[model samples]
Target: MKYKSQQIAYWFFALCILLFALQITYGFIMGFARIGWDGLHDIIPFNTARAVHTNLLVVWLLSGFMGAAYYIIPEEAQRELVSVKLAFVQFFSLALVGVIAIVGYHFNYWEGRKFLEIPRELDYLVVVNVLLFLGLILTTLFKGKRQTTTAMVLSMGLLFAALLYLPGMIWFDSQVMDSFFRWWVVHLWVEGVWELIMGGILAFLLIKLTGVDREVIEKWLYVIVGLTFLSGVLGTGHHYYYIGVNKIWLVVGGIFSALEPLAFLGMALFAVYMYRKGEKKHPNKLALFWTIGSAIVSFIGAGLLGFAHTLPQTNLYTHGTLVTAMHGHYAFWGAYAMIVLAIISYSVPNMTGRKRFDKTAGHMAFWLSNIGMLGMVVALGVAGVVQVYLERRLKMDFMVAQEETKIHFVVMLLCATLFTVGIVMYMYEFIRYGKPSDEALEPAA
Candidate 1:
């Protein structure tokens, strides 16, 4: 709220909520398909729904991260955004690309890669869109009076993420080579640079909300960056194990991917320790809950659950199974989704001049969404274990195993319903915050 340009973030966050709702709708579609309810199979098949669901999740999070940058960079850099107009242009273009790519999926216009489903032509549009975004952020920082560590780390993360997208766009005839580079985009972003983005945002929030010294918090950020590179870089081997790579990857991946959780562990400890060490006078208790919750839950989801099947021996049986789904849900939710919500919860009130802190609905949204996701993960984990036992161990037919697993989908649907309800309530609260205002720059009395 310090600068009028910061209000641009409101629109991006709005887009984020809209896409997130769409994502949950598609998730419900897939969940129902799993249980033999294929009413929409002809119109929107499972593959289509899955693509929409996962892609929407990624888009929303990216939108949220962009919104976070727009809001944080102005304050951290001690100046207004360089060009608010360009930021809007970037935002709309990004949304347009997402909409086009998502709509195209129904018509089978995609690359067929797991996470890199957007067509190559649309990929170029995405690249242009991100370049515009990074240009606005980085230009503003350099022109400003100061460039804090928080701003630099965040800007660097955004830059690297943009650069990393190129590897996926490369044309490769060999499936193994294609898969190898695909992980450079997918695995490196989540396990690598995205952590830097998350850490930067977390540090900014802690300094503001927890009243911690900047020096103390930024020190932790350095440790996190170091740990992320140390493990996450080599951890790319985990995907190479069965992808026609050399046998050396088996050992490299097993040892390093196992160590990947340490970075997450460091994040959890950093948040908790800072929360305990700092003066907690911030009025936004709900934001505090989200900030703290994201840290702890990420440790469990990304750290512990990821470690569950990280080893070569365990992953051999569990690869491509529902086990991956279980980990994906919690890890993405805890590490990325929850942190996005946390920043939204913190920034919305300040930007919009609405003090809806600690509302019953807000707390309900937090707990319900988290608990529902946990239940869903448990159901998926159980289903994955049963599948590994029936198919991998016993050598049963795949169709038989899938039939047996249909019952678990019922449980998954129920949990998803709960999670959806929570999201609905969160959206409701977001709407209640109303529009941003120029008069809110002054501290609320």
Candidate 2:
């Protein structure tokens, strides 16, 4: 049942890896700047690097999601893609738009909004790119023999994700209004539909790797989706507590945001329960590690740390501090980044017909990257606490407070280097697997 169109995903993944490496490079730039190494300040500057670093994160993750769709949709729908040629076209245009946007950031050609800084002019192009991608995917699903729940859920997530982008694209006169709607995009995506995407992908991986019944696994998906929408939508209010919005948001946002962790808790328990319940012991242990790790870590990172400051009382003090950074980094790593890597680990072997599934290098990549990221999170958390105490509580000057926290960034950089090594090891495994071939599509004996 393997189709040649599935090969298209490999290219998108290649692009993903490229952008991720660039992201880490820029992250290092920002890290060094924090520690007083401002060699690139005149040229790149912290603002520019910050925008590039964050934007690249979004784009690369999207690339991974799209690649996952391209791979999964064909199999789930039980057919070849409606148009592989158009899929390639969408792929190139995506890379083109991402490159243009990154280059523009260096020259100060972007909006100042965090996570949505690609500018209005470029926004149209992004809309078009996403539309083309959606068209291909939906068309394939429509024309296919049967559409499974996993396929539908993944498609729904992708579709809703595209619709949500429009809110951020609109220009608002009031800063309050702009920031309000901006959370609609940022909070809603990471906490809302993105969880749907994560759930669908997680469901697929569990079904394959654990031999769980589809009905049983997908039932958990229903619960996860319910919890996500119930909490995540209203949780948007937490951002509005100090943004000059309605006072009602204080009650609404606090109550619902606190409930958000339940969804992630469900996801973690679901993955572990499914893994332990299944009789099949799939040979891809590394993929299992990532799959299980994603679930557990997301609960801790996104669920626990997020709840740590989500209450109106704590958020007032930690709103724009590095504490937010602490939550953001770990949440994204656990929720989105690890899941994408999990799928890549699972799919790459099947596509390339290489089963280097148990390599020492692969194990190193997982442990090193996770350990390094944990260390980074701790460093950022420590710095954030100090910043909040000095600048917010003690009313010290911001510059002085930052100087007091320089040593933490030094720790962050050391851990970041370890993370870089792990990623390099991952890239090595990817390259060694080589490219997909027609021979890989042959039915197994």
TM-score of each: 0.99, 0.99
Candidate 1: regions farther than 4 A off? 443-445
lDDT of 2 by residue, 1-445 (tens): 2887888999888888889999999999999999999999999999999999999999999999999999999988878899999999999999999999999999999998999999888899999999999999999998998888888899999999999999998789999999999998999999999999999999999999999999999888999989999999999889999999889999999999999999999999999999999975899999999999999999999999999999999989999999999999999999999999999999899889999999999999999999999999999999999999999999999999999999999999999999999999998999999998777895633
lDDT of each: 0.93, 0.93
Instruction: Record all residue pairs in model 1 with backbone atoms less than 3 Å apart, i.e. clashing.
Output: none
lDDT, candidate 1, 160-254, per-residue tens: 99999999999999999999999999999999999889998999999999999999999889998889889999999999988898999999999
Range of the 10 consecutive residues with the lowest summed lDDT in candidate 2: 436-445
RMSD of each: 1.2, 1.1
Model 2 ranges off by over 4 Å = 442-445
**Over all chains combined, what TM-score does candidate 1 have?**
0.99
Clashes of each: 0, 0
